[model samples]
Target: MKNNWADAMRKNVHHLAGSLGNLLVESFHYLALFAIGGITAWAAVMAFLGMMEKGNITVDDILLLFIYLELGAMVGIYFKTNHMPVRFLIYVAITALTRLLISDVSHHGPADLGVVYLSGAILLLAFAILVVRYASSRFPSAKVPDPDATVKGALTEEKGET
Candidate 1:
């Protein structure tokens, strides 16, 4: 009986520790999300102010805004679905590279320009690979169920419907 009591106490403590760890992880996740959101907002505001001061939005400025918008969309999607889409990151990278090329063309030599273009091409290839991977999947992983659908399913079950 003493051994059993000790074992029970140990199990309970282990379970409590696991729960606390999960809670801590979730708390940090939310904190990081909030930080991303705040930084994105700051970037957007700064970009807008810069454009306003210049009285004209150049292509580079517009590309920077596109990057900010992509980052915001990535955060919003992750917040809603808990999934980070790689395509958005790729899109942001492509935009940033294009912006760099456009802004630095006057300063870069022929070799530097070639390197930038090569880098952009490589990123485009990666994006193509991702698209192919997604398209060629015969059986995609199950998506997270919608909360409303879950509730409806439960209600239908309680009403004895199949």
Candidate 2:
């Protein structure tokens, strides 16, 4: 009887420790995501203000704003779904490369070889986005349930709804 009691106590302690560890990890995950989302929002606001102060928004400035928008959207989607949209990052890369290409061509003329390389990189990223989209569509994974859905389900059950 004493041995059984000791085993039960051990198991309970192990379970408690596991639960505590999971709670800590989940707390940290949420905190870090919130910090990232907040920073992205703040940086985007600052960049917009800078453009307003300049009073002349160039193509480069517009492209930079697009990059910021993609970053903010990526963060918001990740926060909502707990999944990173790889395509958004690819979109960001393509936009950044296009901006760089424009800047390089304007400063160095059309004879510069860097334009070709940047264009090639942008093309590759566009292809990668296509491939990712194809694979996701071909073999979609299970969707993550919405947090509110569970609460709504419980409420429905309590109300004796089918």
lDDT of each: 0.82, 0.88
TM-score of each: 0.72, 0.82
Q: Tens-digit lDDT track for model 2 on 26-119?
A: 8998999889888888988998999999998889888998998999899889888779899999999999999998888777766467777888
- Model 1 / residue 138 / CA error / Å: 3.7
Best by lDDT: 2
Q: Least accurate stretch of 10 residues (summed lDDT) in model 1? A: 106-115
For candidate 2, list the clashing residue pairs, or say none. Answer: none
Name the TM-score of candidate 1.
0.72
Q: In model 2, which range of ten residues has the least summed lDDT? A: 106-115
